[model samples]
Target: MNATNAPDTVFETQRPRLFALAYRLLGSRSEAEDVVQDAWLRWHQTDRAAVRDPEAWLVTATTRLGIDRLRAVRSERIAYPGPWLPEPLTVDESPGPEHRSELAEQVSIAFLAVLERLGPEERAAFLLKEAFDYDYDQIAELLDRTEANCRQMVHRARERLQSGRPRFEVEPARHRELLERFMHAAQRGDRGAITGLLDANARLVSDGGGKARAVIRPLLGGERIARLYWAVARRNGYSDWRMGTLNGEPAVLGYTDGVLTSATVAVSDGEHILELLTLRNPDKLPIPH
Candidate 1:
């Protein structure tokens, strides 16, 4: 398409990619959408004649805006009332084999949680490089750094992330099955029944953004968390629990009275659930009226 090709069309073409990048960088859906909107406004105001590749131009703009937003959010997270978790991306996405192959391993709650440890620059560099398939030269150009500097940032980010996660694989099917059983027990207020599905050192993290009922601290030990789930069910009755794909992984999507209320994702070792992440914050959810 020529420079005069409908600008809105061009922008819409890139919106999904841009939104995904921003969401990964900042871990907030609303913040990411704001960044994408800002990028759109800039695109609208910029000189189209001067822009050769609109995709590249828009990507650079969106990524930079995301970086800035991430910095601000990181500071805000410091004063957050409790442990923060990424806003769950609930999509009824049925990826083709290729999409699944590309993202199945990396896009998970555990992976996103590790990203929170990275500095803003390091995280941006790493995400742009790995997820978007940007080259070092392009990353350097976007960040206004030397190629060597971008490479170093990527290296540091990779090192930090890899230092913790083992080089082993876990089956997504196993994790999905475990969550089904776990949620089933919880829905029945049968807390002890699901104990066998958990790792002995399993952990439960609840993020309610201080606007909902969430544990102020992460619940450690399988028994304690199971009891918590049971108690919630007993008190509130069974939520409309369903399974949905979130960040390329199978997770339990819980709704109350036909509105999305909660989400839970599990990190398993192909055996038992090692970590369960529950996001109950209405702010982070897409609640239907």
Candidate 2:
């Protein structure tokens, strides 16, 4: 590559990691892309030769940008219609080998929902330390806080996320199997069969953004969730459905005349689903190829 293009090559390599960090922080692919594009602009204008660690510089820039974006969008999310959900992303969208352990579960829609409880700084600190496996000192630098402060932020974030987290991890195969079973049962309008695959405390949350048809409030309890899906079936809603992966988990995508309609992601504990997130908002259904 020519000298003029060296910076572009370098920035492109770090793009995936940067986008992943941004997505985790903002929970919106479009917002993450905006942050990444901004990062690229800054990187291009920086003194590349003087920069010792390009990755570190880009990561820090991306994290700070993500934190800022999260803070800015907080109020908008609060005023959003119904329950707001993290924008669903395709599994192949930005999967990078550099992500820390349990990347899939960390990026799952359910986990992102739990993260909504954390403040912007706490979310950044916790994700940098836990999800991305950065050192406390590094997290502190990234968030412009002291190491001790960063630790406390991570601690608080962890405590808040713990209560809403799934009790146990489920293998991908088992997760997919359970989702398939649930889909079949829901299609058949077999309320009993559907409830049997859900935990007693199972909850269903959908985001229609007030522009589509969806439950205005969260539906709690296995029986209630099963009944809702059964009703949808009776209305011929699940007539055309396909299994796919979204937010690193098994998901069912509903379509009409080959147009994507709804995408439902299931969070299971090996045997039963603990939470179900369905995105019926047409504005949020774009799957990255």
Candidate 3:
């Protein structure tokens, strides 16, 4: 196809994949949409004839833009009001089942929370290599680093990921069961039952952004975590919290006056809850109820 006609066709063919890549890397649907729009503008202004592989070119463009924005945003993150979770996506259009599943896995609360620990370059390198399956050479080109350096970044990121969690998948049904029990125990002020559902070293992290009451530091251990939940429930009283899937994983949504005020996603091992992440910052609740 000629340069004039090729850009339009190429854009339509590649937009979805590019958006997916950007969203997984950045962990915000709105930011990902912005990145895609910026990529399209850059593509439109480029001399298409000079590009041999349009898809590869677009991918490189999008990744670089996302990386740049992430670097600029990282400094501001330290000053962010509360536990900064990635913005939740509210899918208006129905994508196919496979696409939906893939998006969920990539943008899950657990996955995005982990990504926050990496440096911007490391995140870009790892996302490009792991999620996109880009080779060392391609990744090197994307990050403007040597192939050896790119490989090392990916290696470090993989090691961190493996060392952090068990390889167990918490089924949705079982997750719901555990969450219900945990919530019931908290509401009833039954500390024993609440602690029973938690791992010995369970952690509770709350991101109320300093606006609502949340533990600034992660509360560790089953006893401590259970006590914290009970205290919060007692102090605030249980709003009408509904159980639902946040990113295809079990979650609890706290609502007041029919508006979702906050939501919690629990990461569990087979027997106990490992982590409880509550997203109460109004900024992070952009996901539609």
Worst 10 residues of 3 by lDDT: 91-100
lDDT per residue for candidate 1 within 108-141, as digits (tens), equals 6678887998988899899999998999999999
lDDT (10s digit) by residue, model 2, range 1-289: 9998889999999898899999999999899999999999999888899999999999999998898999999999989999999986663323232322355566888888889999998999988888789999888877778999988898999899988886675667777788888888998999999999999999999999999998988999999998888887888755777776676566787778878888888778888998899998888988534
Candidate order by lDDT, decreasing, is 2, 1, 3
Q: Global lDDT for candidate 3?
A: 0.78
TM-score of each: 0.87, 0.90, 0.88
Candidate that would win on lDDT:
2
lDDT tens digits by residue: candidate 3, 117-209: 788789889998888888999898877899999989998998887766558886656766888788777777778899999999988778877
Higher-scoring candidate on lDDT, 2 or 3? 2
- Considering only N, C-alpha and C atoms within 3 Å, which residue pairs clash in candidate 3? none
Model 1 poorest ten-residue lDDT run: 93-102
lDDT of each: 0.81, 0.85, 0.78
TM-score order, best first, reads 2, 3, 1
What TM value does model 1 have? 0.87
Better of 1 and 2 by lDDT: 2
- Residue 194, candidate 2: C-alpha displacement in angstroms: 1.8
